[model samples]
Target: MTTRPRTPSRTPSRRALLRAMAALPVAALVLGEAPGLLGTALAAAPPSGSATRYTIVPFLNSDDGTVNVYQSDDATDFRLVQSSAYTPPSNRIRDASVFKHTDGYYYLTYTTHTWQDVSTTIGFARSSDRVGWTFLYDYTVPIANLSRAWAPEWFVDSDGSVNVIVSCSTTNDEWIFTPYVLKAANSALTAWSSPVALSGIGANHIDTFIVRIGSTYHAFTKNETAKYIEYATASSLTGPYTITRTGDWAGWGSYREGPALVQLDNGGWRIFFDGYGDGNYYYSDSYDTFATWSAPTALPGISGTARHFTVVKETVTGGVSITKNATRSLRSVNYTTRYWEEQSALLNLPVVTSSSATADKQAATFTVVAGLADANGYSFRDAAGNYLRHYNYRGRFDANDGTSTFAKDATFVARTGTASGAVRFESYNYPGYYLRHYNYQLRLERSDGTDLFRQDSSFVPATAWA
Candidate 1:
């Protein structure tokens, strides 16, 4: 399996690295908007005033294997990264849950088989930068006549042991599913111990997701019989779990499943669940853990599209990133020795040497700023104070003329790249187009879905040379 190599000049900060776990980024899709939602506090907006960023990429159940990526500053709204962003080789990609490993790569655990099919295995895939994914071998769950293994979620315990909790159906009806744990033997999560049955969580339970708060283990699972999400707690990973609240405990009504939780920046908890019976999606908040929760609030726009899926949230400082308001150099992904340089208004790739001139370094440096068009996006300002924008799809260093067109042309969204930890800048107005080098000249071009195109468009946001 290929992975991106970290830049030697700098790595992610120690604090940032320690703060993130794969299961940490989740929920709050809707909090205070719902009528019954009371006693819950609103979280501050992120990536603008706050330091955090929220994202949810849900896969359609009908999709053969497509997974769409999303980005958001606040948990309230989300923007699609791309459609069919990544698809596994075969079967369905249902409940594609994601989390960032300590290795700095994003990993997914998914339901490989359809709900009706007698599935014996779960799907696994890993991405270096969350853009391109490489499929690993399918892991067979050790269950006799296993009808289905659905909603596999990543759980990194306090002891740092990576485990996956899955609801397994041993019956042919697929109605009775018991939660099971598969412990990873190594950091890579490739080798795992045989499935061990969860002690207290018995039959007729599915979509079991667990999170640890303080020393207590909180499990939010669905009861197929009662048609309501039940809350449980345990002192250990595999617990003699105790059900604390059951049957409309949060007033979410019946037919609620797929319970997931995310910790807000305010230290509150946001839980997302699927209102499948009503054909909608909802979220609720709890300021004091799950002891007390607000009423269910329906999620806008994503009510039907995201039936069962995964999301992510982390500090922007955690990953290899180009900081806004800071100066940085763009190093070519395919040509690491070359940097983007401005000469006579046009952008070009110039090879860097040990004896590279100071003037050349100054031309390579650009100050990263919030996008004039979309604040969540970014724009580059050069040493000469000119913004780099596309003119007739050609990249150039030109002054911002303060026009609406100029703002759109200058804005870009940095997307995770292919196997290089570098980021590719997708054009703001043109979704599939990227700033790429052709014959060493920079231009905005539409992706032809080629490896050469991905390599060409990708660039590392390196330390500023000037």
Candidate 2:
């Protein structure tokens, strides 16, 4: 005879009750439509710009015994993208993390049990498109003394290697959780390296999320003992990390957990987490550094019942494109050592070999503003909001303050790169000629119908806004 599932003796917290209520029609009411109706109502329209932003949440369905997918364009508003149950062998999924790798596949990793249980395994899945996912493998950490695993998050390194970090507890002391790192053999999730403890032996850490700032890897984690969010940084992914900062910012309530971070379209960073036992997600922004944060505010447009969701900026139409509306430092294909510099007070080009000689004078940050037709073209803008215009019949390129007057002249068709991750900008007014670098300067020149022109016109993605 089949036995009924046992309910643990521990009292359910307010957040736990909210999570249960989230499996009901609350999301439908917040979205103002039936959850099942979303599949047909929201067709896959072309994204506004070259890239699209998405927030992914995996919620446990109380009715179906499966994990449901909720997605949002703006973090505030959400829709049930996948009403179909995502069921693994363990029949539960929580703390979901999704990553789109350089190999052009989406990978999702999650814990296989509810919050109270001792989970020994984590589930993995892969998808060509984010909508449909296929189960890949379940990873069981090789630690003989380990008792539980929770909140697994994976990152794809610059070298195309995949690494997963999870909160794990040992059999000796099951109450305290520490972070562990596991390296995958490949994108297919075929094999994994033995788990290595990321935190010190007795340190209690959970809900870890890793992000790369320049060459440094910063791991933001929930300190179980301190009851606050703390960040640590390391030179490499596998690290002896140094705790850089700790403590919740002013106005954040006593209880905060599950830290998720996303870089905004305007060169700022926002950190999100559940706060105040209300089940609503609160957010804080850091304009300069992660050390200091603004007053916590309830993120608008999200369900008050959601928890442990992740937001990632993705390219919907274009293949691996840059984030739109953000300032970026563009480097030249021909002059690999030089960058497209805004030299002098005027809008003339002078390639700079070193960004440090006159750092402010080397302020070459250009924002990729959208064009008239969403898919047709784009315009580049300076930090002061001046439009970079191709004037005099594609004869020269300069930043013009004329706004919409030069918008048509400033717009250029964005061509996909011949290489997988490269992109080219071609003039709209002049078809053959593209924005290219020559003699350490910017100019519009004819392609001459060769790979060299494509190479000269091509550029690697901007590292960060100068």
lDDT of each: 0.71, 0.59
- Candidate 2 global TM-score: 0.58
> What's the number of clashes in each of the models?
2, 2
Give me the runs in candidate 1 sitting further than 4 Å from their true place: 1-50, 61-64, 317-466
Candidate 1 accuracy as TM-score: 0.59
Best by lDDT: 1
Q: How accurate locally is residue 200 in candidate 1, as Cα lDDT from 0 to 100?
A: 88
TM-scores vs. true structure, each candidate: 0.59, 0.58
lDDT of 1 at 265: 41
**For candidate 2, which ten residues in a row score worst on lDDT?**
28-37
For candidate 2, lDDT tens digit of each residue in 320-358?
345677777776665666666565533333455444566
